[model samples]
Target chain A: MSALRRVVRAFPSLLRVGLAEMVAYRAEVIVWILTSTLPLVMLAVWDRVAQDGAVQGFGQGDFARYFAVALVVRQLTGTWVVWELNQQIRTGSLSAALLKPTHPLAWFAAESLATMPIRAVVLIPLIAVIALWRPEMGVGFEPANAPAFVLSVLLAFGVHFLVQTIFGCLAFWLDQSLGLFNVWFAVWALFSGYIAPIALMPDGLRAAVEWLPFRALLGIPVEIGAGLATGPAVWSGLLVQLSWLASCAVLAAFVWRRGVLRYGAVGA
Target chain B: MSGRAFRAILAQWRAAWMAALQYRSNFLADTLVTALWVGWTIVPLWFVFHRAPERLAGWSYDESLLVTGFFMMLQGVLEALIEPNLRGLVEHVRHGTLDFVLLKPVDSQVLVSFGRVVPAKAMLSVGGLVVVLVGIARLPVAPDLGALLVAPVLLMAGLAALYGLWLLVVSTSFWFVRVDNLSYLLTSILDAGRWPMGLYRPALRAILTFVVPVGIMTTWPALALRGLMRPTDVAVSLTIAATMLVTSRLVWRRAVASYTSASS
Candidate 1:
């Protein structure tokens, strides 16, 4: 409880420092944002595939809308904390964060969130251009699912952050944890509806993926935002997603505690 | 090139090889990762084809594998050769450590371009060929003598063009503080080349084919192998690739001159 209080109190200053760090590395931040444009590339391929009439009940508009919403959701939820953790640990710079008064995880959280302003600056124009040029893409607000979509996105961000932190903690012991993370990412890419919509997935894969946490982090919010999910579907997805949030939170706390205990920093 | 220049380049690569040998585990891990990545690259296609529209703009499942195989080979070259060198070039520029490199006796372009290599990453090209063979096995007709001959040529040309494109991206750092993001953006955009060019809308198709030429780099070669490409396309792809190479080299020279322009 006291740790939570310290984290909350320190967060604003942490965020401010993180924002300054982001400004200094603003170009690299743009690169990070641009790399997530994989969704747009997939959008192009799937949009063309859908031109042959509805496959699994998704027309060109449906494909475009799903991917457009997906782009926003991806940018909102994404962070490369795992890669950063690996680099910091390897270079021994993580010692500074360890020396901080607050929990080091608070600083990581701030570092991840501070990139939001730049994302918004870049995405607003992008979304506006898409809205204007391809109104048929229907990149817009969904009033009914809007409130739930917001809640789901925030929870999804929590899941993504915690999951990266859990894997990031692996750097304390592993020679290179990024390789292990790649295996997870490869699975996530397949099951998270990254290449194609989950609705279009084969029956067996869809059935399995629906219960998994992979989709909870990305696909659910995208589905809600694209108007694919209704009242019950949205709530049920949020239910599954909330459980992932809780599970990952517990796992991350445990893993980080264990990893930090064994951590030996060789720094000046 | 003179034998002495050739020897200097060889020595640079040798040093890089010895440096890489210092990290022995990376070789084993990276080779394993490359092999896994080869299989994972096919999974998306598996999902897309799990149902049946039969073809992606007339590309059958086995045929699409040819394109994916070629794309994998290109990524192998990118990781093994292009990215490591470009990264070194950019870091040198950013940190102003480039002065040490500039003081060297050898040609700076050769020094930077062949400056770093990850030989382990080239294992992906070997893995890519296995995929190509797997793709060829399921074909309705075996690849002919001409295809057997032409595929490797296009692969080399595609690699040359890939380096040129990366070189072009890195050249901008000479003027702009950082255009490293542009290289990353180019990489993600090139992800589109994994599919048939016909799978894109016309506007994007033209851009990828000519403007960026990623389609020419990967898909045109695959098409040539299948005997599906026009004879003129071979000439055009080779010509365009050569043109991009020469143009980027010229641009690089001009960019390098600017770096020295202020100091003089």
Candidate 2:
């Protein structure tokens, strides 16, 4: 109870610092968001493929919707905590973070959330382009499922944050966990609907990907945003996403404790 | 081109090689990451093309693979030979280290361009070559000796155009303090080059060919290797490459003249 109170108390300050940092690195943040342009590239290819006829129920219109939403979802939920945590761990700056009363993850979460506004700057133009140019992409609001969509996007953000933090903690033992992250990113590019809509994937592959966290992190919100998954589908997806989130949070906490122990043993 | 400059460039490469050797584990890890990236790119080609009966924007599956190979090879060369150096140019300019590099007897442009060569990163090109060979073997007829000879020449021309494009981006550091973000624009543009330029609309295709020349750097080489390129196309591509190179040199000279050291 006290710990929870403490983190809640620290939130505002942490967020303030995070916002300052974001402003300082505004150009970098824009570049980072812009570099998530693979979806646009994929959109072009998929758009071309759908030119002749629909592929797996995805017409060119559907491709535009899927990829545009995918880009928005990706930019919103993407986590760079692995890179931050890895650098801190490697450089021994984590020791300072450990000295803080609140958990370091709380600070990371604050930093991640704080940068969203700047990231949203990039998304506005995309939203404008999509809204003005390709209004038929069907990315508008659904009042009925709006709650579910928001919940899914929020949970997706949580899931990615936890997953990246878990991977970041691997820096305690590994030479460079970012390399492993590259491997994860490569796989996620295929499975997470960044490259293609999961619905358009082969049956076997789609079935296999459904249970993975990558799909929950990117594909679900995108599906919901596009109005593909609704009612029971959205409910079941939220349940699975919640479970994954819980598992990752527990795992991250466990790893942080163990990593701190190891850090202590090394006398850092 | 002078012997002294050649020795200086060789010494820079030696330093780069030794630095790369020092991080063998990181090198191996990078190699694996790049290989997985290759798979990441190829699987999409299979997913998109296999589902449809028609050629994607006029390129067949095997032909698409050849484009993919050229994309990988060109990207690998840029990653190994060019990116590490050019990506840091903005930083050097910002930190005022470029002033010392300019003060050196060697040509600043040559030193900056040829300074870093990571043998491990070049493994991406080796991997790309394997893909290219596999793509060639998959074709109905092997490339004739003339086509084989033509491929490397076109490949060099493509590389020159790409370097010219990169130089155009990096040269902006003289006026723009935060031009590092500009590199992201370059990569984003190049990502479109992974496929044939014909896949894009006419306007985009023209931009990719004439403005960025990603088509010349990637598609032309792949086409030459596959014996699909025409004499006129090859001549046009070489002309674009030379023009871009000359223009970039002119821009570099102008940018350098205007450079004011950040330390000052």
Candidate 3:
């Protein structure tokens, strides 16, 4: 009860700091969104190819819609905290967070959540563009699926955040955790449907990717948004997402415990 | 004039090298990061080959690997020298550090252009070149001595063109304080340079050559490696690089002239 009370008390201050940092780096955020334009470019190229004939299951319109949805999903879910956490842990500035009464994960979560307003502003326009420009690709706003999609997004964010925090915790052991983070990101890019849909991948690779947690991170939400999966599939994907989220949470907490014990506060 | 510039250049290089050695582990970590990144890039190609097992845009899988390898090399060089140095322009302008750069006796452009060398980035480029050589050995066509000799020259020209393009982007910081995002805008466009330009529609191919010139930095070199370049393309690429370098220099001067320090 006391721990819950402490979190409630610290929430306001945490948010204030997160907002300040976000505003200070507003230009960078804007640049990051603009730079994530690869999907759009790919969309153009793939749409052209699909004009000749459908490539696999995707027609010209489907390609346009899929990749356009990819742009929005990628932007909304992306996090750079692996780099930030690695830097803080390596430099021993993580001690500052440790000194605070609140849980460090809470602080991390707050900081990530604080950036949502700005991202929302960016996403709204993109959602509008997708809706207005690509009408054919629009999923009917089924009330039942809305709850599932929302749940999936929350789970996606949780899985992604926890996984990154785990990577960040590696800085305590290794001198540089960002390298591991890079490899993770490359894998995420390929398996999470950032590069292309898993459906388009070769049979063997696609099968392998399905068994992994990466698809639940970005791909499932995208697929959900496109109305590609429904009913039992959505539930099963969410179950997998929740399982990964739980595992990552456990692993991150375990690493953090060990990492903090060894923490010398050297760089700080 | 040349003597002073030469000394200044050597001093900067020494400083950068020393700074790199201090962070040796970070250097190796970054190199590992680059290798993993290169591997990630290859995965898509691997998948593509698995799907078709045939030539994409008239180039075999091995030939495509050559293109990927060369493109990676060009990218490695950019990340090493130009990208890292110019990346800080926005922060420098915002914080008025541009004034300190201006106060130096050395040319501010040269100082800014050659400021930092991420040692890992150099290693990445070398790793990429190794990949290119490996790909060449696997190819059905054996590149002769002439082609091998021309490779470095073409790579140099590609580097020059890349530097010129980045300078143009960094110079925009003078006008737009938020130009870092614009730099990313450029990067997103450059990502398309990974694939051969011929794979793109003609319209995109034309735009890449004329407007962005990423094609020259990546695709043309790959073509040269495959022994597909005509003398005309080579001459045009070299001319373009020279023209871009001069234009970038002029732009930097003008931008610097308009620089009102952030402190003011």
Ordered from best to worst lDDT, the candidate numbers read 2, 1, 3
Task: Point out the worst 10-residue segment of candidate 3 chain B by lDDT.
Answer: B47-56
Cα lDDT of model 1 by residue, A124-148, tens digit: 8777765664577663346799899
Clashes of each: 0, 0, 1
Per-residue lDDT of candidate 3, residues B1-264 (tens digit): 366766887787788878878888977777777777778778766754554425656767777777778778877777787787898777899899889888888878887887677767777677778778888899787877777767677778877877888898889888987676676678778878777776676887888886788877777777777788888888888898898899999999999999999996
Please provide, for model 1 over B215-257, each residue's C-alpha lDDT reduced to its tens digit, 9 standing for 90 to 100: 8877876787678867687788788789888988999889777
Q: Which ten residues in a row have the lowest lDDT in candidate 2 chain B?
A: B49-58
Q: Each candidate's TM vs. the true structure?
A: 0.91, 0.91, 0.82
lDDT, each prediction = 0.83, 0.83, 0.77
Query: Model 3: how far is B215 from its true place, Å?
Result: 2.3
Q: What share of the true interface contacts does each candidate keep?
A: 0.66, 0.66, 0.45
Residue ranges of candidate 1 with Cα displaced over 4 Å: A20-25, A132-134, A137-142, B11-26, B95-100, B103-105, B177-179, B258-264
Ranking by DockQ: 2, 1, 3
Can you write out model 3's per-residue Cα lDDT over A75-176, one digit (the tens) per residue? 666666687777887777878878888987788888887777788777777667656755765544345666787788888888888888888888888858
